[model samples]
Each structure stands twice: as structure tokens, then as C-alpha cells.
Target: MQDRIEITVTDGVADVRLVRSDKMNALDAAMFKAIEEAGEQLRNDPSVRVAVLSGEGKAFCAGLDMANFAAMAEGGKSSEHKGGAKAVPKTLAERTHGIANQPQYAGWMWRELPMPVIAAVHGVALGGGLQVCLGADIRYAAPGTRLSVMEIKWGLVPDMAGTQLMRHLLRDDVVRELSYSGRIFTAEEALTMGLVTAVVEDPYEHAMTLARQIAGRNPDAIRANKRMFNAANYLSAEDGLMMESVEQDAIIGTPNQIEAVMAELEKRPAHFKD
Candidate 1:
């Protein structure tokens, strides 16, 4: 996985980078597997308070590799192989990884992580790349970075959990227009459309600084806040209120919570445990 993706944890922040800059970090079979594996690794690690994702070199990601498209055009399966043999291709409707398939999980896995994930997007994020960015809890993009729901250009839909993620972030009409047109939009426009959290001159640096600030807070409360927000996205108003109460109830009297209050009273940074 390190060949395609690299992860380094510092002060509870996981810095994840896509290293396939030679190909603009395009999603090939190996890249797909690497991304999923990276997410799984971070998900299982109790020490990771937050994660910042970025791509090395020019572009964040250029989406699906052109080779895969060529393979599909020639009637070859674009699926990955397992072990020493080619794995049988599964239908899109099949749920191979919980609620998502293999390819979709590459993007959706970030959302499954217990801690928040921030994406620092630069250059271009199209099709699958854009879907991956959507999976992050927060996204910061460099000014003028290009983005799109570009699967339509290749005669496909945004199947990598893009529709599910986008609907929550954008209006129905905006989603339809972007999905149908496959037109490139700049980060400034994405900020107006609510696709990106902010457009800045240096996204990675900004993301890391925010990650450090979040890491200094009470870990349990930060995690509970993320869980509550994620559930609120799909829960009923009553259920959402109950969830908030439940999460707050669990954290109110905890050691870390007390530490947070004491830290503020004492004018010192809280030291939270993993």
C-alpha cells in the first residue's frame, strides 16, 4: 500500500498522500486497493485523531486511469485481481464491502473512519477523484483547482459513492446539472456551490494547522461530535435530537471533558488520551 499511498502520523494527525504523481494519482486497480487499505489502517488506529489527505506533485487526482477505460472499451474487465488470479467482476448493484462495492469503498471508507478526514485538493479532481474528496468530512482546495462530476464524459455515472455524498452537500438541481454536464469548475465556484469548504492559496498547510488545533481538544468529544453529525444527515428530527443527547450524555462527565474545562480554567492546553 505504501507504494501507492503514504501515511505518517504526527501528534495524532495522520498525513496521507497519494504518491502516484507520475500519473496524476489516477485510480488504477492497485491505487484503488491502496486507498481502501489506507483507510482501514487509519480506522483501526486509536491514535489517529484526524487525517489530512493530499496528492503529491501537480494534481490531487485525475480520476480513473485512461488504461482502465481502454480496457473496458476492448471488452476486458476493469476489475482488480486477487492473489495470482483475476477476480470475477461483480455487478454494480452487488454490495461487496458492507453498503458499498470494492471501487466505491475506495472513496467511502474515509467516511467510515472514527475521526474526521480533511482533503487538501490541488490541480484537478475529476470523476473518481472528486468522489474521494466528497468522502472527506471537510475539504480545502487551492485556488483555481479544477473539479468536476466527470463520469458523464466517459459514458458512466459517478458510481464511487459520489451521488450519495453529493446529495447531502448540494441541492438536487445543482447535482443534476453538474452530473449531466461534466463541466470543469474552479475551486472558487466550488466554494459557492458548497462542494468545497474553502478556497485558499495553500490548502495542505491550512488543513494541517486545523488538524493540530482539533488534535488538542478532547478526543472523545471530537469523535462523538463527528458521529452525531454523520447520523444527523440521515436521521429523523426526533432521532437526531436523541442522538445529540445520547452523545452529549456519554461525554459530559468523562475524564477528558473535565480536563477540557480544567484546561480552560487553568489557561493550559488539554492533554487528551487516545
Candidate 2:
């Protein structure tokens, strides 16, 4: 990975860091590319049972770089890639990765990954940065961290998987309030409003600690749980319950399941299937 982003995988956990501290880890073309690459790499790596994403700077990310905004104001041609080199499908509804195109895939891909992804948020997570965090299965935020759906301030809508993720996390009115007002909120407020998984003094540390715990679990079972939970969001409660039963049945008495039970009974760590 480029210096703009750091990707490290060890002990079945991948830690992906955005390293543009000098720029507050702002989203530029380079950062977008790096994030996309990192997500793809983790997706393809079967050994990675969990992943943590965070920024190495005073902030997580400060949305779009000023230079890009300045160029747009000057009526420069839009540099946004139209799904990269991938050929467009005949109908938008038929695209494979749901509503995501190539640029959006950078954020959406994290959500689609079978294993859990955690976002360690600190300082500020605004616009595109916040959207990226939303893609994660869980968000760990620093106590005083600021978050926002701030695209309205830039005269643009969040185009990086924000809408879809917000829909899953916030009530309709709550989503509208955040998106329409472009207001920034503290981590405490985020926790109260269900925007973050937890508020901590050190988000990255908390996230990694959680990742390690997850890494010690039965990998196959954990992934199956994630899949069922993801499906639950779009399915009726009854249907979701049925799906859960089906998933549980698939894992019961399986090697990983038996290992998990044996580990618990023996007071030892699980030796799970990758």
C-alpha cells in the first residue's frame, strides 16, 4: 500500500490506517484510491477475520481536499471516475455491488466483506470520511470526536455510500435532520443517537482490542452471524428469524462450532476454521 494508507495484517486482524496526517487525512483522489485498494486487499485475504480502519492524524478525515473544491469552482472538468474501467451495466439496478459504482465501491465494499470491519474514529469524521466509517460494521469514536453528514455545506449530496448506511443506522427523521442541516455532533451525541458503537478516550485502542476479541472467536461462526444480521436489515423479522435458524443449523456440529464449544468447556482459546 502507498504511504497515504497503511495496511497491516497479523494474527488474523488487518489494521488499515489513513496516514495523511499533514492534511488531517483529508479525502483527495489519492486517498480514495488508497482506501479502495485497501478494502479490496482485505476482501481477498481469507486469513483476515477482522479489520480496523482509522486515520493517523489530528483527525480521521476532513472531507474533500480544498484543491479539488477550488478546481470544481473554476468549472474544471469533473475528475470523478465513471466506475473506473469497468463497463457500465445496461440498467443501474442490475449492477453487482448494489447501488455502488467504482468510487462508491471504496466505501460499500467494506460493508459487503464477509468478516466484520470496525472504524476507529477520532477528531473529525466528516462528509466522505464519515461515510467511510458508516460502512464499517461497528464504529468506535473518541469522546470528543466530531461527526457530520456535511455534504450540504459543499452544495453536494454525500455520494460515497452515506445514504444507504445512514438509512440502516438512523431513523428517517434523524437521518433527514443530520443530512439536511449539515450539523456536526459530538461522540456522546453520536452514541445517544445510535451513530457510534461506543465512545472512548482512545478509539483506536478500543477498536483494536475489540478486533482481537473477535479474532479469537470461531471465525466461520462470526462471519455467519454477520451475514445473517446484514440480511436481517432488509428482511422481515419473521424471515430474519428463519434465516438465523438456517445459519445456526449450518454451523452446529461443524468443525469450527465443535472447536468453539470445546474451547469454552476446556477454558482455552478457540481453534477456528479460517
Candidate 3:
């Protein structure tokens, strides 16, 4: 895990970063498993109220490693191999992480987290890197950041929750055009396409600012909100309203909610537990 990502927890905000600067944080076999392992930890950590995802060096990521394409060119699957042994869950179709397979979960697990996640995107976020950004609740991209749905260039389609996550963020035509062309678009273009929340000079600082704001909120209410918003994606209007009502009812009189009320009444900050 240390070879692939770095995770630090501070003041209820979990800072997660890809650490493979030499390769522009590109996804290789180890990186795929490492991301899944990190996601698993974040999923179970109750102290986390907010999270920020970023890359350590020049780029958020430059898509799949060249070795992955090499494997494809040789008509073999891309997976981890060590000491003449192969990892289990040998295929991409297995549901190894609840609703997603291991590779897909490397990106989708952020969506499954109970708290809000902000991605600080800079440099090139292409292919799988772009899908990882899509998994976040919000994305803050740096000015001039290069992003693309680049699977088409590799004779592929967007399979890493890009189809699932992107529908909520982009128009059908724009998604199709990007997918079809695999063209790298600027951060400004991503803003117009709604693929990013904001294009800022410093995406990391902006993301951290937003994360701290969210971390200050009542954690129970934050979790409740995440649930409601995620549910709204698949539920009908009538059903969505019903689900919202149920979630709101569950949160209205909770201990954390009461703390939020008292803090406001007393003009003091609130402290919440997971």
C-alpha cells in the first residue's frame, strides 16, 4: 500500500493520494490492488467525515500503465503476477467489493463511502484516472488540467464506472462524443461539460477548503445526506421523496442532530461522533 498510495487522517478529514510520481500515478496491477485496499480502509473508518483524493506529483494520473496495453497487445489479460503465481478473483467480472469488482471498486468505492469526497485533479487525468474523478462527490480541477475518456484509443470503452458515474454529470451527447473520440479536453472544457465542479488555479487548496467545511458539519447528517443523494440517482420522484422522508426522519431527532441544534442556539461549535 505504501508503494501505491499515501493516506493520512487529520481532524476527521482523510487525505488520500496516489504516490507513483515516476509513472504519473498510472494504474498498474499493484496500483489496482492498492487502491482497493485503501478504499476498504476508508469504508470502514468511522472517524472520517470527509476525504480529499489527489495525486502526489505532476499528474493526478496518466491512465493505465503501458504494460497493461502491452499485455493486451499480446492477447493476454492484465493482472497481478508474482513469484510465478496469480492473484485470485482472476477475472474483471467478479463482484469482489459489494457492488463492484476489484478494479471497478478501485474507483467506485469512494462513491460507497458514507461521507463526501472531493477530488483535487491536476495535470493529466486520462482514462481510468478520469473515472476515479467521476467517483468523487465533487471534483476541483486545476486550470489547464488535461482529461479524457481515453479508452477508445486503446480499443476499449469506459468500463470503470465511467458509464455509471458520468451519466449524472454529463449530457448524453457530450459523454458519447468524448467516449468516441478519446480526446483530451482542458479543465475549462470540463467545466462547461459539468465534469468538474470548478476550475481553479490551486485545486488542492480549494478541495481542502471544501473538505474542511464539510468536516465541520454533523457527521450523522452528512452521512444521511450522502445516502439521500445517492439514492436519488436510481429512485423515481415519488420513491425518492419517500426515501428522503425516511432518511430525514431517521436523522431529525438523533443525538448528533440535537447537538447541531444546541450549538446553533448557544453560538458554539458542535462536536459529533460517528
List candidate 2 segments past 4 Å from native. 76-98
TM-score-based ranking? 1, 3, 2
- Tell me the spans in candidate 1 whose CA falls farther than 4 Å from its real position: 78-88
| lDDT for 185 (candidate 2) | 92
Compared with the true structure, model 2 gives a TM-score of 0.90
TM-score of 1: 0.96
Report RMSD (Å) for each prediction in the order shown.
1.7, 3.4, 2.0
TM-score (all chains, Cα) for each model: 0.96, 0.90, 0.95
- CA displacement after TM-score superposition, residue 236 of candidate 1 (Å): 0.6
- Model 3: ten consecutive residues of lowest lDDT: 81-90
User: Which pairs of residues have clashing backbones in candidate 2?
Assistant: none
List residue ranges in candidate 3 displaced over 4 A. Answer: 77-79, 82-90
Clash-forming residue pairs, model 1: none
Q: 116, model 1: CA deviation in Å?
A: 0.5
Q: Which has the better lDDT: candidate 2, or candidate 3?
A: 3
Instruction: Please report, in order, the local distance difference test score of every candidate based on alpha carbons.
Output: 0.90, 0.83, 0.87
